[model samples]
Target: MKFLFIAQRKLVILRNQDFKDINPERQIEITRHFGPIHIHPTSGECQGGSPSSR
Candidate 1:
């Protein structure tokens, strides 16, 4: 769910260097509420973050 969403975002970022502005922590929060498919326009990709759950 949330984890998956974050994974998706991370993938997007990896693909687009410009998406580095995405804050990993903030993305986690969004994923917590909106699940993993939340897309962020600024990053030009889905809202996602670290999947480590660390």
Candidate 2:
């Protein structure tokens, strides 16, 4: 699942999962294809001035 990777990138990595060491910008590029990324409520503004969905 795509969400698993996104969450893993922030939280913990599970055994047997392929880990990617990507920069934030590159991460966005990869994830954008899955649709808009979710930002935390307190994270403030994201790329292009888009506010957090929360």
Candidate 3:
């Protein structure tokens, strides 16, 4: 069995704008969609993967 994990940095851009930070609403939306994104520092040691046929 294989589980797909996607990892990417979170960023916010303001083109030709004067905003110093991302909008709260947009941040919330992003978090809602892509939040809880975690990674297994050690692939086999992490508990995120499926059970193996030991």
Query: Candidate 1: where is the Cα deviation over 4 Å?
Result: 1-20, 36-49
Best by lDDT: 2
Per-residue lDDT of candidate 2, residues 1-54 (tens digit): 877877877643457744266545666676677677777777776445553332
Poorly placed runs, candidate 2 (over 4 Å): 1-20, 43-54
Please tell me which predicted candidate would have the highest TM-score against the true structure. 2
Model 1, position 49: C-alpha lDDT score: 40
Taking every candidate in turn, the Cα RMSD to the unseen true structure, in Å, is 12.6, 8.0, 14.0
Clashes of each: 1, 0, 0
lDDT of 3: 0.43
Output the TM-score of candidate 1.
Answer: 0.27
**lDDT, residue 10, model 2:** 64
- As for lDDT, the candidate ahead, 1 or 2, is 2
Error of 2 at 36 (Å): 0.9
